[model samples]
Target: MADWASLPAELVRRIAHCLLYSNDLDCYMDFRAVCPNWRSATDDPNNSTKLRFRPFRWIVVDEVSETHSRLLINTFSGRVIRKDLPLLSKYFVVAATLGGFFVLANKEPPHPAVVLTPFTGHMIRYKAAVPSYVDISGAALSGPFTGNCYEQYKAVPDSDSFALDFDDEEWGRTFVSMRLAVASGMCAFDNWQTTVAVPPLPLSLVPKISYLMRLYAIDPDKMFSDKPVTAFADLPGTGDANHLFLVASDDGEVFAIIKLQQHLKVFWLDNDNRSEEVEPVKSIGDRAIFIGYRRCISVSANKFLSIVANSAYYVKSTDSSLAIYKYDLEEEKEERVSEAIDSLNQGRLSFAKPPFTIVQLLSSYTVNVRESQLLEMEKLKRQQLPSVPVVRGH
Candidate 1:
């Protein structure tokens, strides 16, 4: 009965959070545009405790053939958007989140650096180092002109050691020559200023982890000058690494799926010490397959939460072969299992095929692996399987 504008700021902000965390994704975006007060309440950090409640839409990308490709972005409820990134030349997706912004790159050569953010519908082109190959993966940025990378494939993007100045609104290209430090897998903190860059160096130099994954936690600030430190965690070698997603809790702990051999390993890492505590999330991975393509989409209902991922399924017999899966941790246990784990394992399983996936390490330049293979063979002895187990059931 009273005017909404006359209400206390705290009350209005609380209401905004409720709206943002609601199941309706459309209204969240709409409310952000309703008035400056609403937008401020939703985006402001003081009111951001509600940000972790939103759902995430995974964007799945897969190659249909040598030339033709399919790009899909959607939520788990069948809401989808698709595009084709033809292999005629080169195509790459740079930085993305569960939110609507997707920074995509094109590999046309001679003029190779282009970034596209789907939400603002803004596309910007940068001067990529010429005579240099296009390693689009190095092109991770929080916003326009505020990220770093090594000259394509020559190095890995490190959050703990790279330079970033997000508020300057000017692009710096000096990292085109920096050496590699972090691993191939990096994490983008909930706050853009604190993106995590992984090490590209070998695993032997670090602790003994069977599989590799990178996690970056950026301190919330406009100037991207802080260097995120490095940390390591163990994962299952036979599980799908790509299925691993990163999410940070408001309490300063980071969590993700370890995807172990027999169960899903859920780990909580201390943001300060990088010390880890592991717990079994479920026995879900044993039943699921990580085939098809995966992508991350950002949508808001209350506060901005990065929890959605979109996946496209490849089924030969159905017209509805293409599907989307959305996940939110705040949902009921039954829903998380049904949407996140169960759906991924739906197709037929074959042992001859890869139980897990191996994404070809992408680099800006072409490196001959023949020499690396020769070195590997010289360094390690070959081991063969002891025997094959007979299947008792089909």
Candidate 2:
């Protein structure tokens, strides 16, 4: 009989590619672990840019356990990868996660912050003032360093000394203060850092005018430019009860997600015209969105078939514990998925060290898969391995 383990290296690579594309992180890892040759054939996700995939692995703090260790869990596969951090005891508060790096800040005074990649154990320290909040867009990090508010309203100084009425066009055009509301998240597309902000509320005394949202894009390199800032799109603002979230789809489309009391409203940013507008979206095709303080991510449901498409997965906090729920966009309904025991009711558990940030794991990385169907695929593949034909030497 032919040796099944003796499959050609090229064939093994093909198998690894299939597993990677399936979004089965656990299976991919298993494939590499089969032999030294297979391991060498597969690319390391951390170093390779070609094997990028949707983030399925989450870096979360395991507060429920007595060890207080940091864990990397694959939501699809249920595999838990744990890492210990002696520094976590002193710097427990996670400020942000950007470009696959975690920014951890010390809780006490003389506070210092460090950027770390949990999987790689790479660390960099920053001695500057710790930001109240931090956001990562590609390689750039942005947050309020000097101010206390993430979103603030500042009056525009009237240097001309003209008592222009709010109704005047000049007041509307020049004096209209820039009302900046820092977005819940940041996304990068075509080298532009994009975020959504609430446009300055209309100054008219009349009640007919409505609040509108502005989409802002900046080139991180230039910092300042003479041209008027590009307003990528305009979104119709709902009442005060609604909150805005920005997320990027796997295909690089930007979406504005508004969270109400019970349901979520999603909008697609359409920039075909000079005046960009947000179109209300009832469905997200084959994608599912995960939003919380930890990270905001959108993954393809087709690749990870176990997770339902056009749904929103979110975390909610109760008196004693924190629970995760899936909100169906098509059905306009919500169902609970998992609940973690946390007596503090802080709901502070994140995929990474900092409390609120996004983590994007490339396709080359492996995550645990718990679903029976996914496991069945691997079992079937092994069963189908061709038996070697018997040959007798004369």
Candidate 3:
């Protein structure tokens, strides 16, 4: 038999990429641990930093109504890993975005958001200056922190915090609709940076298309471009801004999803500058689409045998019931997946703080503060708050 360890470096890395591509993160970790030569062939991620080929398809609910909350599910494989994250009891998932990035906010008073990458076990708490409120949307890091160095994103154990602000273009004001900008605010920490921005839409678009979905690729600097900018290609029919979703395909094609009273419509949006166009589509062919609060992601079906291609998975919620349903594009119907939320590894979670996820990935980035340590710091922050005194009434 040929020696496996002596395999070519390029071949070994390709195998690693294959595993990550399938969202078999656990298997990838084991593959790297086989030997030092194999380990060095692949790149690991800092829990919070977004890097290419990192698997983050797992999901976490904001608040835990039950002990065993459905933790992570492989959308492709139908594999579910359910466990109770005690630390998340006080927080709720505000939005589940692409790349496994979740916008989480406190369930208690003085609500603050922790944009977390559950698998990497890292969170960035943003400090918003808005009075009595913190908007957790608009702009954020386009992609996870990626570079040759990991130390650049290390968080401070306790005092590690980020700040936000809104000012006139005189300082750094952008030529955008102040109303829309303020309505959909951005929350980027001081250390973490964002590359995408929501540009104002034109009056000609209000009746024809929905508000533009914020995704990477649009340069924020272009807001000041001398040439005319088409910002976004308008579809023929109008869609509810809330029901619309934009996701990129594995091959980099962007798809827009519009959810209606009975079925959902998918459209192909081309990025050509000269003829920016939107075409209505019938089927996804060999891929599955996953849509969350205001986010959508498309993945290849061949990667996992269990995922139903030409379909989309979305939440069907009402005043009394909530469930995840699969929308078949080919069949033109929607059906609920049985046990969309189920269990897997239980021992991986830590009650002390959010185990966020138990499938730990190897990363060189140091975790400066675990959730356990931050508990005290949170209390300290509360203690340090200024106490307003009342003046004596005559």
Candidate 4:
């Protein structure tokens, strides 16, 4: 038999790539543990650009007051990694997670929000808007704020526009309606400061359309533009604004999910200039979606067998608990996934701080390694260690 242990490193690397693509972290880790040569052949999960799999774990706030430290729990292995974030604990409230970064708002005065990469310890802060009550929607780095009250003050800061005026009941209703829409997932961010508003609702006078879905391409360079490239599509059925959610898949496919009480209707956006349509989808292929107040994420279901495919895992705004319901594409029926919550956590679940966003654990940007004495020791060891001879594989 050929010597499997001494297999060509390039061949081993190709195998590692295949394993990672399958979202088999456990198998990939086991493969690395076989030998040093195997380990060196495989790319580190932390640094690999091609490895876009959702984290097996997340950093969540410990609900128990006794333990103020944050708990990093692996949903797959049930392993908890505890750490202290003094800055986060003292001055900030976590609002959301985007691209492996936490969005934090200053709890005290001024109330400036920041995008923080916990692992890398990189932070980008944004100045607080003039209005104190503006509802921020989307990711910290790229999202929009909604509160028309500030619009008047923008043109004339010193004018009477700043004065509190809520006498008009119609105006109050419109303000409340806009605020509610922002609270829902109706907003998208072009960048850190600008928000792209959803297209206005069609008037009742217009012909009734079974499905009405619109897509807008935002320009980040322009703060606010009067015209944006827009596309419209008809869905299978009319969906209410309150029960609709727009989500982007890992591969950048946009999907619209409509929740009618217990049932769900999923439509995939087919963006063709000649014919824009929302195609009914029976399955999201290998993906599962998580929807909550903070943000919605689409992850590979193959990696997490506990989370079923073609399902929506959601947390109600009023309720703190998380729930999962699978939608059968064939039967067009929605049913609760068996023990989904239990599979996620065994004991009392620790939720993240206010805003309750889920963040992926990143090893590349850990603060512990930067501050540790082991870093110096490793440097010294590297200097003294002799280089190993490179052996060419036959």
Candidate 5:
């Protein structure tokens, strides 16, 4: 009989190294339990040469355990990937970004926060922890993020303004008068640094007009130069915009959308223009926009039968209830939100923090929901491993 357990180290390593498109990570956890020999041959996920940011699309299902395990649903294929991350058992999925990273935080005394790649088990300790009082709404990256594995990242929380920057991580705080959430479906990681400039001075109202006209620099560091002093006086539109949300499409078009009552004005922001007033855009192709929640994103809805293409979706919390809104971009009218998405919140989506919803479950968990089946990661584990070894002494 062939000596299966004694396969060549090179062959064992090669067989376990499954690369996705040769540019990203694939089923990495399964090989670790294949056998003693295979586990020895495979590289640690953190130090592996094969790992690259693949930009996997996923949605957190009905619930998130306080620690240990989670169920993630693929946004496109609806396939489920169950991840056993003990690092995340105590954290909340506070914020997310287009780079396929989930920013996890806990509001307890430790106040720990970390960046996690759910599928691959890549972890980065953050420099800042979420304050027990402030709620993190969303996060944006300045450049290609390589969150260090050393001490917590150097996160700078802005007490004066709402914006929080931790190295390249821009976490959006939710309790301010004005909020900004940035995300792009495309590979915007290449040029996101040039898109987060804030005018040094406060925005002057355009009298009764709802539109904000600004010629502010794309970099906040350029505030002392010469444009921010007279930015808001030459504005268009009428009355104060109730809410403002920004999203970048797959083609790299960044839009700042403002809401006044039921009306929404979409402005095409030119990242290259150092200081220029933005104008309203009439079209944004077949993409759908999402904003004003735990995270904000834009995706193509051309394939969905029920999801309206060229539309926008948002979540708003009133004194009475939390409601989701969908607005048509072309017609400039509000549409009905999907029911399948309505039950997803589970008190996790809220305006308060340090006490965002948290629940406890078994050390083991499973879920495969939405447009597909509720699969068990345990089932996947069984398929991958020949047997579970009972070795002792660490």
Candidate 6:
């Protein structure tokens, strides 16, 4: 046991990689807990060559009655770390996700953005407000930028999408807002430092209102540059014309599934562009792809996206459950015949599967709701009558 403890931290991490490559998450997490060196190895990017772990840390924001921002951390041991969540307010904590390394805001009323990493329970605080250009209904960190989904109104519909660069130190309200609508069906991923927004339909192919459907190709850095931006393009008509398709790719690619008339069709972005109409890459079965809950969605570079769907097909709304699907990508064959043959021998097929094998029984966590409605209620009362509108005389 002393010999095991004496091994260099790097070598232990190598051992962890060997274990992880063999699909040994249990052993890997165990190795991370073996000592301080083992745990530190988990954050080293160089070790990521063999295996990549999600960069962000997730924490459950308990809806306690605390006035200040705080974080509840689990050490993968039973130990928990609690600290202030920067400018976290009681109301905001209820609607946050634990996907990324840090959480920032895109709402009004400027405050210092909150940044935390659960491992150390240490934080970096910035005094800035959420940019006005982008609205964050829900956001997850894809690389250094925050990929967000936002609604235009109070009604149940798709929200406009955009990404904000959280790494910027200036916090000058600079952000890139992509006008992609994933009000209902959309998938997203942060890979290769780019945010890929795929429409539910093969948007690039539709000719009329193609601009509306074409995949939105945006780089938040570029969008935030000092340049006037204007462009328009139409989507090509797919196998059908009425269905919308939205998709997310783990490796910076976008896939779209659209319903034309009543037939469901699938398409992919041949090249990254929101204005070009590409052809169909595949056709899904007659069954439509299932999109999850209003706010319960996440995309990971590991080639899977999670959605909150109903447990039983015919179950009532109250019986719905969350499901996680690992949507795999189609590997490309090399030009070399030997490479092609090697690829064929590997038998790597593109498909989707569930990663959360145990919790096929899990459901959406209840979103704690608080009311700022009292202010509105009072305003409504003041507006009523006011002496019967002065009898149309004032």
Ten residues in sequence with the least summed lDDT for candidate 4: 363-372
Q: Return the candidate ranking by lDDT, descending.
A: 3, 2, 5, 4, 6, 1
TM-score: which is higher, 5 or 6?
A: 5
Off by over 4 Å in 6: 1-11, 15-33, 36-91, 94-110, 118-120, 130-135, 138-245, 260-263, 272-277, 282-394
- Please provide, for model 4 over 1-394, each residue's C-alpha lDDT reduced to its tens digit, 9 standing for 90 to 100: 6555787889999877765554344455666666458867765667543324433133343332333355554332333455555666654443433323455555555555555644435676656322344333322132222213322222122242224434465333333222222222222222212212122221210111123322322111221111110000112332222244455554445566664455567776553322434577878887766543223445556655455666666532213332334566546776544222211122445232223223212110110011112223345668899999999999
Once superposed on the true structure, which residue ranges of model 5 sit more than 4 Å away at CA? 1-86, 90-113, 126-153, 156-241, 272-279, 303-305, 316-322, 338-394
- For TM-score, the strongest prediction is 3
TM-score of 6: 0.41
Give all candidates' CA lDDT scores: 0.28, 0.42, 0.43, 0.40, 0.41, 0.31
Report the candidate with higher TM-score, 1 versus 2. 2
Report the Cα lDDT for candidate 1: 0.28
- Stretches of candidate 4 off by over 4 Å are 1-83, 105-113, 125-132, 139-242, 292-294, 315-324, 337-394
Tell me, by lDDT, which candidate is best: 3
Please, what is the TM-score per model? 0.36, 0.48, 0.49, 0.46, 0.48, 0.41
Cα error of candidate 2 at position 107, Å: 10
State the lDDT of candidate 6 residue by residue for 302-347, as single tens digits. Answer: 2212221111100011112212222221221111101000011113
Residues 41-119, model 2: lDDT tens digits = 5556774433333232333433323353555644333344566766555554443332234555555544455666554
Q: CA RMSD for every model?
A: 16.7, 21.7, 12.6, 19.4, 16.6, 15.2
Ten contiguous residues with the weakest lDDT in model 5: 359-368
Worst 10 residues of 2 by lDDT: 362-371
In model 1, which regions exceed 4 Å deviation?
1-29, 32-100, 105-109, 129-252, 255-264, 271-394
Looking at model 3, report the run of 10 residues with the lowest lDDT sum. Answer: 361-370
Cα TM-score of candidate 1: 0.36
